[model samples]
Target: MSTARKHDPISVQDYLAGEAHSDQRHEYIAGVVYAQAGGTNRHNAIATNATVALANQLRGTGCRAFNSDTKVRIRNAAGTRFYYPDAMVVCRANPPSDSFQDEPVLIVEVISETTRRIDEGEKREAYLEIPSLAGYVLVEQSSLSAVVYQRGRQSGGDQGFQRSIVSGLDDVIQIDEIPLELTLRELYEDVELAEPDSTDRS
Candidate 1:
């Protein structure tokens, strides 16, 4: 029998370089890459609600927002990374590539059950790597709760911490970059989340 030696895993550099040619988009984590799952109807609706709401609020402002289809590059000490955010707003600087916005002032990821762990853990860590990143929003599909992680320092690195969780629908997250406020309910207006069953006791 013949035995073959396995090769090393792909690095963040390799993933970013071949992202365009790759079959699908993947999230970078700890120098490893993982593919994102296609979201559900509820997920889509939730993301749409947030994006449109932000668009409406940021219309006259200089910042422009995008949906999950937009690619993003976040840099950390490990390497420069990339991920597709659910709702992203950029107003910092325009780049020559004109393909994907690099520095977004605000980024929101509607967390799905399948991707929730990564979004809350890996992706959450990845977005903080960006220097221009002032805020990171995580929208929960199971409920109306949304987590907002903000950076206190004008610059990036290990200077910021998790600001707070904007759980209540009435609560609003302040976007210091473009300078706007988004309500939790607004981000889940069209979203029809599942209701908790009363009889399902373990």
Candidate 2:
């Protein structure tokens, strides 16, 4: 996503209003709006696969899975922000009149080269602050791997999250909060992963 250049800060009300009529989607950070760029075929496929899987499993469970078009509203001491996660599951449905969801049980972000930083850092931090959020997942488009952060007690006996790394197509992500388990093969179905760069070393 690219930051809107030379744009003045706008209020949350104004941003929401503008977004309703705008052709493209933008993420609101405090008073600034960042224009979201289109994703690659692989990115779209992964997101769709995850959403479909979740939706299928959540049937008759009183929970709903939302696609990227739906926004997740974040309100904290810093300010109000709205973000479009790749896919999200909300057990407590928001009112039909509401355009954004305030309580998502699970939030998924399909990470790409351009969005890796923000998705893993800023967005992860913000999403974890939500009391209703039980898990935050970051899926990689370049590989069959995912990083999951599940709400749990820390080693220090304080409420926090536990990070788990899931790799390989045989692996699966199990979230007891949503009572769902998704395997890597299912999430990457028909999606062609990008070739790794030989020169890059992490």
Candidate 3:
């Protein structure tokens, strides 16, 4: 996402300062800040459902669930960057007092038409760079599909990740990061998903 700049490149400090009081939220990349788009009712509901499910299961487990308001920092070739995931679970018993979290086990995003590319591509790569992150989930708003990318260890001693595409309501995720099992039904509960287009294939 290319953020328009009015003058000289702004510092990260300035971006954080502006984000503190700004009515709207923005993502800081390198030295530029890009305004985040507003989410629809469906988007918000999906995020809320995921958060609630996570929170209920994580109660007294020492893990905490954070909503979109919390930012996550990542260091990459592009330098330090910050993003706001729709839902995140940090396993740290005692995290820092900063407004953002640096080590999250799971990072979730409810995909929208406007941000599909960035979420699935750029953000996906960035999230994987985090050693503490175990998985990155992308929930589709227009359908009952969710994709999960999780770190896995092969028998050959190679370390990488595996990707799973879950669609049916019966499909459930058994992640190693948390003690809870997340099902598609729990995520889409009490919410209406956007109908697929007539020409949609698979």
User: Candidate 2's residue-wise lDDT over 34-82, tens digit each?
Assistant: 8888876778889999999899988999999999999999999989989
Ranking by TM-score: 2, 3, 1
Clash count of each predicted structure: 0, 0, 0
Return the candidate ranking by lDDT, descending. Answer: 2, 3, 1
Candidate 2 wrong stretches, greater than 4 Å:
153-158, 197-202
TM-score of candidate 2 versus the correct structure, residues matched by position: 0.92
Global lDDT scores for all candidate models:
0.72, 0.87, 0.80
- Stretches of candidate 3 off by over 4 Å are 1-8, 93-96, 153-158, 197-202
- Evaluate residue 32 in candidate 1 and report its C-alpha lDDT on the 0 to 100 scale: 61
* Residues forming the 10-long window of minimal summed lDDT in candidate 1: 1-10
Tell how far residue 79 is off in model 3, in angstroms. Answer: 0.7
Per-residue lDDT of candidate 1, residues 1-202 (tens digit): 0012121367755766767687656665456666655666777888898889888998877787888777787666777566788889888655755446788888898765556666778777777777778899887776778888877754554557556877778988886656889998898786677443211110
Of candidate 2, the 10-residue stretch with the lowest lDDT total is: 193-202
Show pairs that collide, candidate 3.
none
In candidate 3, position 28 carries an lDDT of 84
Residue 24 Cα positional deviation in candidate 1, in Å, after optimal superposition: 3.5
CA lDDT of 102 in candidate 3?
Answer: 88
Better of 2 and 3 by lDDT: 2
Off by over 4 Å in 1: 1-23, 28-33, 93-96, 153-159, 195-202
lDDT by residue (tens digit), candidate 3, 97-148? 5778888988989886656778888899999888888888998878888999
